[model samples]
Target: MLTRKLGNTGYEVGAVGLGCMGMSWAYQESSRDDDRSVDVIRAALDLGVGFLDTADIYGDGHNERLVGRAIAGRRSEVVLATKAGLVVDDLPTKAMHRDGSPAHIAAAVDESLRRLGTDVIDLYYLHRIDPAVPLAETWGAMAELVRAGKVRHLGMSEVSVAEAEQAHRIHPVAAIQSELSLWTRDALGGVDTAVAGPAAAGAGQAGSGDVVRWCADNGAAFVPFAPLGRGFLTGTLHSATFEGSDFRAGSPRFQRDALAANLRIVDVIRAVADRLDATPAQVAIAWVLAQGGHVIPVPGTKNTRYLRENAAAVDVVLTEADLAALADAPPATGSRY
Candidate 1:
């Protein structure tokens, strides 16, 4: 697989990385097997897909512990990244709230390090800016983590251009992770037409400006989460039926009629994939890759077969004609949430 530099950190990671959220929380919770999830992470590392992404709030710390176990001995072979600033309020309900206070930032690092079984995190992202806390205070606290050597680099997620600029002034924003799939282009300065999830409030308002371009100008990596549209873009999601605990079970985009309309977007992706002799998942990921060299997408999954399929996207380049056809595809019917 090919690789790309991790922003100004000078670290080169897999062009397409693995998002470990599903293995722990969001999708198909009943099928989650720690042994299988661990193997998937290990398999990803073996395949050069070593940029592992997770968050402390995922499964209320379960995800971090799993990742800690997975990379126990082979930590050096991976560039581990995890997030803070979001606190899980209820494990059963998956309820969460933001806490960007200095105290929260300070304590969360120690907790994350303990759960991750690491001394220093390669990339530490403030999961979301707490509306109650000043951005500078939250970012300043994160910068102190770097100065204290507890964190190597700092990043942000779902922030507007103005918010990003504010934080970048305090410290270099190494990466900005947000929803940027075929249906979600809000990060590119376009209007967010879909209904997003709980954290969608942090997503920039309409005309937030092109954050992808901002990262390019400021030397930060633009990390696109859910590059496969939470499995909708894979062309394999033929039904709206999902587990009660699954995040998509209540998402607007996953409802029956909405999903039916969204399938048209997948149809276009499938056509391009067939032309390239690649899976729809790869075509979706490759389109994200075309966004920019610094764009590293973390498509989450617990299935090793899907992991291999996503990693192969590095070699699946879309032609100009393919790009044009995709660009002309109809808008999604439901919101991303």
Candidate 2:
């Protein structure tokens, strides 16, 4: 239930924000189970981790609607952030694509607002930049959303420093979300420059000590998603049970060769977990939290059992020695993408 200021946006959210993509789509094909999904979302709010992240492209807008319903009566108690720019709406061929043109952002915000069932979105992000369109034009459209009072803040995802700077010229970027984990480390100095970029509004992932320090010094709130490493760190993924259509199924880390080698990393984590009398998932979550007081890790779970265990991470604390041991784990075998 800890909190941090996202840059100087004059708004604050739970240090960690929930990524609702997997709830509706992406990662793996799954049933809707709106009732259960809603329950998990409310549970997160009750725990005070209220920055909910969703996108229009997720489930063709189902994710936003689910998030919208979850926060219906209790909207005021949570910080709602949804995104646009990734076009997943009833694709004729069901192909994934980008759409950051000014026209696309303009039209998408209305739909996101309507689907989210909110008057004003706390934070709106361009899920990814469109190579065909300029970033400045997209940010300009987002700036218009702010003017119309439909959006309060704007941010970008998986973008470079140059792109971020260009977008900020039109409007202040409130946050940046990219994949940053212990194993999927970003290019060194990547986050430092990102957090320090003009907006300084926020940088999404600072799950490591080095990244967190950069965010704090640069005035950016770090929000880490997939802090559980998509169930690998949870100790439920063994080589035999890992073959599936899920996102990790294709992950190099989950491949037979890489997974075999990666087990050693898990072994080290499990040793720490046993010492703390916690699950490896909990240990992983706790370690991310310990990276910095400002870092927030959102570990998603569809089932209440795992949800409860993950929530307990707010109490688990790793010592300096523990951190050093974790840092010394053998190098992972494959690239994160």
Candidate 3:
């Protein structure tokens, strides 16, 4: 795998990092095997997909513990990143709310550290801003973690450029992780991309500005979560019917009519993939990589086969025609909740 600098952290991680959320949360819950997930994480490290991302809200700390177990003996080989701010309300329903209050953030870091089994975290992100709590107080708490040596760098997820600027003044925003893929380009700006669901009230509003450009200009890495459009751009999903527990089952874009309409976006990706002799997944990830050199897309997968496929996306270069086609692909139908 090719490497890219992780913001100004002075650390170069694989251009394609691993998102460990689905292993323990938000996906096929019935098939979630901790042992298999551990193997996949270890395999990721072997493939140099060493920038591992997780969050305390995932599985209500189960995901962090699983990641801790996976990297038990080989922590040095990974650039571990985890998050705080969002608290899981109901594990079964995956309901959650933001708790960016300084007190919550203060307690969350120690809990995350203990679960991750690390003295210090390489990168820590504020999963979502709690509208109830002031961003300054929440961010200031995170900056304190950096000073206390509990967290190395600070980042934010699903935030506007204005919010990033506000937090950056308090502490350097090493990265900003948001939903960015061939279909969802909200992070690039010029779209009404407010996040939906429990934290929707606190989600960044539309016209958040060009966050991708903001990161580039401000010396921060743009980390795109769900870079494969939550597996829609992979061209592997032909049905809108998902298991009740699956996150996609309830997502608007994954609903029947919307999904049928969204197939046009996948068609464009598949066409580009066919031309390049690559899988739609690879083409989708490659398009995200094309957004900027500082952009790193973390397409989550619990399967090692898919992990290898995603890791290989770094080499799937897009041509001018491919870029144009992907850029002109129809906007995704339905909200990104």
Candidate 4:
């Protein structure tokens, strides 16, 4: 596996890393079964997964606690990353809000460090830009973390190019994480350089207008959080596979009517899978990888079977023909929340 540096910082990680969010929360109401997920983490390490992505808001920080426990004896082998800035509840079980105040950031990192059982987080991100707070002030807090040696690099999630430049003026951003996929190509244009785009879908978002290229041009890392589009592109949610509060159930794209219409897009992936003898998941991941070396997709999964399949995506090669065919597939799906 290849490695890419975090921002302009010396910190480097495997090109394909694990996003540990699903192991704890979102996608469904769930929790890990013993060390089953930890076993998968260990396996990833053996396969050279030097990078691990987590967030303070995930399971109200339980995911960080779990990741801390999993990497307790193995900390030196990981490039650990996490985010704050979401004004989440202190109760640890409530839905949250956003707070990008400098004081909040200063307070957040210590809690993150304590939960991760680490002194310094390799990459620290502002989970979301708090419109109530000035980005410069928020970034100043992050720079303070860098100064205090509590964080090695600063990052922003779902921000814009203008905001990225402003934050970069305050401090060098290590990575920008946003939604980027075959369908969510807006980030491909430029949103990846700063934060994820299309804000009305959510907060602090923008169009995909070449953000990844800007990051590549600047030697900064571009991390795509939902690279698999919540398993839609993986051919897992074919028909009636989603049930209960499976996150996707609430997404407009996956609702019965939209999903029935979206299945046609899967046929496009299926065509490539049949010809290339590769799984749709592999094709999706490989295309993300093919976008740029600095572009890393943290595809989340609780299933060990899917974990291994996503990991193998690092080895899958997408030729120009394959890229062209997939790119030409009229992005049939709607916004993925």
TM agreement with the true structure for every prediction: 0.97, 0.85, 0.97, 0.92
Candidate 1 residue 193 Cα shift, in angstroms, is: 3.7
lDDT of each: 0.90, 0.71, 0.90, 0.78
What is the C-alpha lDDT profile of model 2 across 172-279, one tens digit per residue? 766766655555445223322123222222223222234434455545555666777666777777863432436566556778888888778788888889988999
**lDDT per residue (tens digit) for residues 167-250 in model 4:** 887788778887787666767663322223332323446563567777787678999877887778888776645545465665
Candidate 2, residue 95: how far the Cα is off, in Å: 3.2
Candidate 1, clashing residue pairs? 194-335, 195-335, 195-337, 196-337
Q: Cα miss at 165, model 3 (Å)?
A: 0.6
Model 1, position 183: C-alpha lDDT score: 91
Alpha-carbon error at 115 in model 3, in Å? 0.7
Estimate the overall C-alpha local distance difference test score of candidate 4. Answer: 0.78
For each predicted model, how many residue pairs clash, with residues at least 3 apart or on different chains?
4, 2, 0, 14
Q: After superposition, how far is residue 179 of candidate 4 from its true place, in Å?
A: 0.8
lDDT at position 304, candidate 2: 66
Collision pairs in model 3: none
Predicted candidate 1: what Cα RMSD to the true structure?
1.5
Poorest stretch of ten by lDDT in candidate 3 = 196-205
Candidate 1 per-residue C-alpha lDDT over 283-329 given as tens digits, one digit per residue, 9 for 90 to 100: 99999999999999999988899999999999998899999999988
